[model samples]
Target chain A: MSSCGVLVVAGTHGNEVNAPWLLQQWQANPDLIDAAGLAVQKVIGNPEALRRRCRYVDRDLNRCFLPEQLEQGASGLEFQRAGELLRLHGPSGEQPCAVAIDLHSTTAAMGNSLVVYGRRPADLALAALVQGALGLPIYLHEADAQQTGFLVESWPCGLVIEVGPVPQGLLNAGVVEQTRLGLESCLRALYQVRQELARLPDALVVHRHLGSRDLPKAENGEPQALVHPELQGRDWQNIASTQAMFRAADGTDRCEAWVGGEIPVFVNEAAYAEKSIAFSLTRREVWPVEPNWLLALKQLLAAA
Target chain B: MSSCGVLVVAGTHGNEVNAPWLLQQWQANPDLIDAAGLAVQKVIGNPEALRRRCRYVDRDLNRCFLPEQLEQGASGLEFQRAGELLRLHGPSGEQPCAVAIDLHSTTAAMGNSLVVYGRRPADLALAALVQGALGLPIYLHEADAQQTGFLVESWPCGLVIEVGPVPQGLLNAGVVEQTRLGLESCLRALYQVRQELARLPDALVVHRHLGSRDLPKAENGEPQALVHPELQGRDWQNIASTQAMFRAADGTDRCEAWVGGEIPVFVNEAAYAEKSIAFSLTRREVWPVEPNWLLALKQLLAAA
Candidate 1:
């Protein structure tokens, strides 16, 4: 069988410190990962930014992984880091790891979540395994493919482990512990599949990404209103189209009150303020998966 | 004697949108402050930052108001804005407003509180009045003189109205209402003082600032620890020095355990992470004040 291994990365944004802290904890105590037999390639995505305690020195490393961005030369620190990381682990790299897991924290009320780039079978099965193991709802980000430059997209079987409501540059121990638990559960699930003991549900619940909702802005693009108070901390709950999305400055009228029921994933994320995205909407779907077949089949095929 | 007008400023940090939203709401409906009969100069600090929904364009506007920094020429948008604001309502300005109230929201567990720069008599009296009237605790920030560049320091009886546990760039309605209530209470107390009807207790509780605690870092300065799980949301609560301050990544030992007690303000503050302050410690003190002397004398003197 092919060597079973996984590439685990944290601090891709530098500001999200809890994941890196958890990873460090894992390194300090190998028992934390005793159940996951896969060879782990632990990486700190942006050590420079982490040292300075900022989100990014130049551009977001999470968004600098595209082949075109890498070929265009190192325009910034993130670009350089992305190129180096790609050369070390990409499909053409000598190490050539297939399954990669990226850790992330959000400044929104999205508790613990799993984000899948698209509906690739291996990715879906892996997400299903994590979901079944941790009860974490998976967020399928498939709509905005054009804007995709996420690190997990570079690998064959890869996904992002997201946790938070914690702000950037700060670490919440609760979030840190949750992230560690999530990581452990993910690794355990992967180990189960590798040992031919995994059993994922035939139909896994997933939140399919539609589009992001931005707070209403004035002519100059300053926010004309804010997220409705009622919707502030309610992250995974479904909001009916009739429900108010934003409240105007006057607090008189509600803006962006849509007409369909959709759930918001990153509700009131502090970091997305710079990006003009209030939250992203999703529609729930039950995706079918081949469960234990993925890791075992892939391992056997690789060995052949 | 000064004219007893109040200059209320909000949105100093573009991300703290609730206070500014409340201010805008009040502006749209003036009757909300009909009782607080003071000439209100409702200024939105960092308008450019607010326009773009960010913390600041160049640097933190709140930290750019040092007298030396002001005289040293414009460093960025904040400096220019500070110069303009000073020109309009500063002590040396044409308007020369004496009582300035700066509104701020923190991404920490700091509940409703008042921040006094130093032990200024008038500032204390004002804080006492607010404490008595609104039942809000006062935070006496006397340490770290070099880092003092707050906007409220420009006026005679200036202070900051800080409220939170809320993240930046997101508005929590509960916090919004709380801020509004706090603002109204402050204004009412000021009006009472102007009318010689203000009453302050003899002993007021205050949190005396000692110093800030940063997360444990490695030789490279990246945080090697996180806030202790036990201390995550315990703001305003007394923490014994024997209690764990931070949990090392290894989860083996507590990193910064001490042997005293301190009440931590701004615990797990997301914004302060960039500044390397995990939390700020304060010693609780009961400050003595001359009961009801402030309003009686000030009003009598103004009448005379």
Candidate 2:
């Protein structure tokens, strides 16, 4: 008997059914998992709300996770159930290792992709495998102080597979299919980890976190178009601006691009807002703060 | 004579500080103007930076009118001048029944308190009565953006006074006495009917722009956090565990909080590192936007 690995699937908000449905389909198709030579457990998160096809019943299921709540044995019905299932089915003794994957969708109009945890070599190897197998861009995020309470942060080698938008009551068939393929790709990547995975892309360390900014505004008070810096090499596209650029900072009314160049990359969610437009990607060269600096600062201040 | 109702002042830069010091001290003396009841010109702005003691030269004399820049600019030369002078001069233009008080301090923190312009109601009022006032705040800053290459957002009712903090000097005893007595207490408020100033604060509006979060370690060694919520005010504060928050739609950490609350009040700056601490300020009632909304969303996405 092979030691089985664990797969974490969530974001079952009715408005976000693609992820759960995709996971269910993948679980039903044993060939997909069998081809990759891995065992899988499918946990349905947010069942009540997912049944209702709504974002949430009371509070957002996503935000209900907190450390105190976990310690006190507090959990939203869905989270509690999911946690219980994982604990009950700890990794199969036969499997030397296990991995989890969380599926999700974005509001922004973007290509199918995945976001991996910061520069952990294991995670990078996994990301490269998935990227190569699934043929999608992989965004790496280095976590920091201000960000807290995430499921992947507490799991080992978790991958957040982001499909495109899933409107209410409408399941994006393309997204569902792509998600299935992506999951299979993950299993394949994990299966090959013992051998070729070591040759995957070296995990690029992101030391200092430069902030994000929104794109410039047009003259008519509309959001200017934006393009992600990473997509530069890819044949990515963007919508056109409807109005001229207006300077919100000093009220300097002028055209959007004072100097002609490619639009800056959009970072974070709410890509439409001005603040999310991050122009420069400040790495260690510009800002040398360690990943733990902000956490340390907050702790020091809290102690003081 | 029509009593001088408004005063206009400008040019209190450290390089040109002769006017501000003289005016500040002059405005302080009660006996300078005729005893006959009439509106009097008051000492205007920036005695400290104009005194040219420290950190003044590097600061730009303009750009202080911006609300965000005002607080950060406080220690800078431009901030002191704007705060000190704009209070006295009011806005530009001479009203039939108004007087302008423009006061200034110089780089030397020396020089006579001179009333440079008095054409408008505010200006004429200061000229008529405050010419030889004891020690007064100098007011000057009437140069146009295009013409004078200075930032004098205030218009019509204007005054230009220059005093000390020039040629490497300290605030003279006379100027200090005048500023304390002439401008500090007496000029409690200044108003303009023509142009609308951004509303002042009856209560502090706390604006918290978002940033990244701390990644948490989970049992599976996978990083986890909450997914960023699309709705406003859904972001939480003081998230202890990094395992619960979600990466944002754009691949950054997520964050959230009430539009105006203790959190925004606590963190004041908007810019933050990708995985670092960041903040901003805004009116309590204002809808989430900018530096605040974008940042808050980023933090929520990263930490959610």
Residue-level error in angstroms, candidate 2, position B246:
34
lDDT of 1 by residue, A1-304 (tens): 2365577899998778888888887776787555366767789999999886667889878888787867888588888998888788765566666678899998777789898887777787777878887789888898685457888887777889899888676677788877877778877777777677778777789898888988877676756667887788778887766678877644554656564668888888766766778888888887667644475435632442
lDDT of 2 at B163: 38
Tens-digit lDDT track of model 1 for B1-304: 2465577889988877888888776776687554366767789999989877668889888887778878888678998898888899876577666678899988777788899888767677778878887789788988786467888877767788888888666666667767877788877777777776777778878888888988888787767677887887777787766778887654644646553667888887777866878888888898678644484436432542
**Candidate that scores best on DockQ:** 1
Off by over 4 Å in 2: A10-13, A32-35, A58-68, A74-82, A85-97, A144-146, A166-169, A195-198, A202-209, A212-304, B1-304
C-alpha TM-scores of all predictions: 0.85, 0.37
Error of 1 at A258 (Å): 6.2
Q: State how far residue B164 of model 1 sits from its true place (Å).
A: 1.5
lDDT of each: 0.77, 0.39
Best by lDDT: 1
- In candidate 1, clashing pairs total 1
Angstrom error of the Cα, residue B253, model 1: value is 4.9
